[model samples]
Target: MRVEIDGISKSYVDSAGAPLHVVGGLTASIEQGEFVCIIGPSGCGKSTLLGMLGGLLPPDAGTIRFSGDRTATGEMTSIVWQDYALIPWRSIIDNVAFGLEVRGVGKQERKAIAQGYLETMGIGAFANAQPKQLSGGMRQRAGIARALASDPEVLLMDEPFAAVDAQTRTLLQEELLTVWENHRKTVIFITHGIEEALLLADRVLVLSGRPTKVVEDLKVPFARPRTADIAQTPEFGELKQHLWERLRDATRAAEWAEVEGANS
Candidate 1:
């Protein structure tokens, strides 16, 4: 599915009742089946944008539209949160089947569908385990399996691998790519790691500080079926440096803006 975000803005009031603008007329278009990664300085409202895209939050202004075939009868979009929002009381397989259940899928059918995704994520063996019994990475795998089982047209991920160990994060990235290759879901991933963005995305959208907007949209040049070894390449290093410079500048500008606002 192709997503068009135009002039979308959102704001909230601070404790002092002062208005805090988080997204300011942010506009960007994501093409069908495109893996787009969003990155920005802290407080840039990346998650807020994702929330609006998923219909969890409303934009104060502007529109978000979807143009494409509705292949799935279930929800149009599913989100994989950073914390792996799973039910502690449910078994891993049950957790994965939750979305399907919510959609009114029959018990045996939902379990079958959920099992397929669990096997795809390489965690089928943990089907009966509770969320608390699994490691951070394992829980995240279950979370992703649950999202995929719903067969959403678009997947919104908010730093889904951020809580896992470095080695586990690398493994999960590769696993996600493999699944994405087969399923071709339109993905909008938000992350603070520039390298993670480069590694996973077909294009990276870099946002400005608070009241954020897309400041830069960069295409990743590496061929698909990517691995962590690509990070050793010179092109990857150069692109990483470029993103670092841009992110540093945005962070500094935000800091200055905060100082000015405090004084004013």
Candidate 2:
């Protein structure tokens, strides 16, 4: 599905009872089956944007429109949070099948579907284990399996691998790419890592400081089936440097603004 976000804005009242705007007139277009990564300085409202996209939070202004067939009868979008967000009390398989069960799929059918996704994620053997029994990386794989089993048209991921170890993160990234290649779901991923964005995204959207907006929309030139070897290439280094510079400038500006606001 293609997603069109136009002039979307969101705000909350701060402790001082003043309106704290996080996103202001943000507009962007995500094409069908496109893997788009969003990156920006800290507190730039990336998660807030993802929340709105996932229908967990509503925009204060403007519209977010999806065009094309709803992929499944379940939900239009599913989110994989940074913390995994799996149920500790449920078995891994049960957690994976939770969404399907909610949609009233028969028990056997949902279990089969959940098992398939767990096997795809390389954690099928852990299907009967409780979530707390697994490692962080394994838990995240289960979380992803749960999201995929729902068969959403659009997937919103908020730094899903951020909590994993470096080695585990790399493995998960490769696995996620393989899954994306096979499923071709529209993905909007938010991350603070520029290299992660370049490695996974067809395009990267850079946002400005608070009351954020897309400041730069860069098309990644790398080819699909991306591997760690790509990072060793001079072109990859150049792109990384460029993204770092952009992020650094944005961060500096955000810090300055915070100082100014405090002084005011």
Candidate 3:
């Protein structure tokens, strides 16, 4: 395993001095190269949990470990953002190589590394293009390339396709699977889209309400290389319905919490 969250919890004091818990004793294990998706209601602190996994935020209790890779803290993660987080002034190749450059990788070597990633993403044609020059999907590919270029043991993605159009989103989904198939990099992807989660994940983690914790961890038994056609299958429908039912409970719980908090 590359990632483990052992009874992890996060809590903070509200402005009024009341205790606020974001995550509650959540636990999960992710094998190296496995793609896992965390899904839950809007305010359930799924993002907060992801932040913990990346070592960007410290949990108030329990632990998140990147086994054998780092001591005391997880050091396996590299994050990809929804907005594609590329510099506007940087060329496509430059943006992809940014991490390597930061690590003091020489120009010739970093450019070669960037070129390989761009070709893999099928965006080599746009190497000289700036961020503004590419389409939304292309820019996202650049971001993925940037993440992959770092060669991290784990990849964390936050709604990476949400910024693109539906068509582009579909294409990215296909491209993402291709990347995963080829590289087998351990990926912890977070998404609000249930279908996207089901399509990409080996396992789907459903979280409940505020003080979010794992409500369900459903395995996806479907075969890989998922296309839009796969979405039309009966098995896909069954999986989708199952996920919806799980999330429905979480949504209701979140709403009730809001109502109760207001009443109090």
Cα lDDT of model 3 by residue, 1-264, tens digit: 478788999988889998988899998888877899999999789788878888889889988777744523333567889999999999999999999998899999999999999999999999999999899999999999999998888889998999999999998998999999999998999999989998899999999988888889888988877777778889999999989998998999899998999799
Worst 10 residues of 1 by lDDT: 65-74
Superposed Cα deviation of residue 94, candidate 1 (Å): 0.8
The weakest ten consecutive residues by lDDT in model 2 span: 65-74
Predicted candidate 2 versus true structure: per-residue lDDT over 1-264, tens digit per residue: 999898999999999999899999999999999999999999989999998888878899988888833322239899999999998899999999999988999999999999999999999999999999999999999999999999999999999999999999999999999999999999999999988999999999999999899888999999888987799999999999998899889889988988999899
Model 3 residue 247 CA deviation (Å) reads 0.4
lDDT per prediction?
Answer: 0.93, 0.93, 0.88
Per-residue lDDT tens digits for candidate 1, residues 37-112, read 9999998899999999998898999888888332222399999999999998999999999998988999999999
Q: Estimated TM-score per prediction?
A: 0.97, 0.97, 0.94
Query: Model 2, which residues run further than 4 Å from truth?
Result: 68-74
Stretches of candidate 1 off by over 4 Å are: 68-74
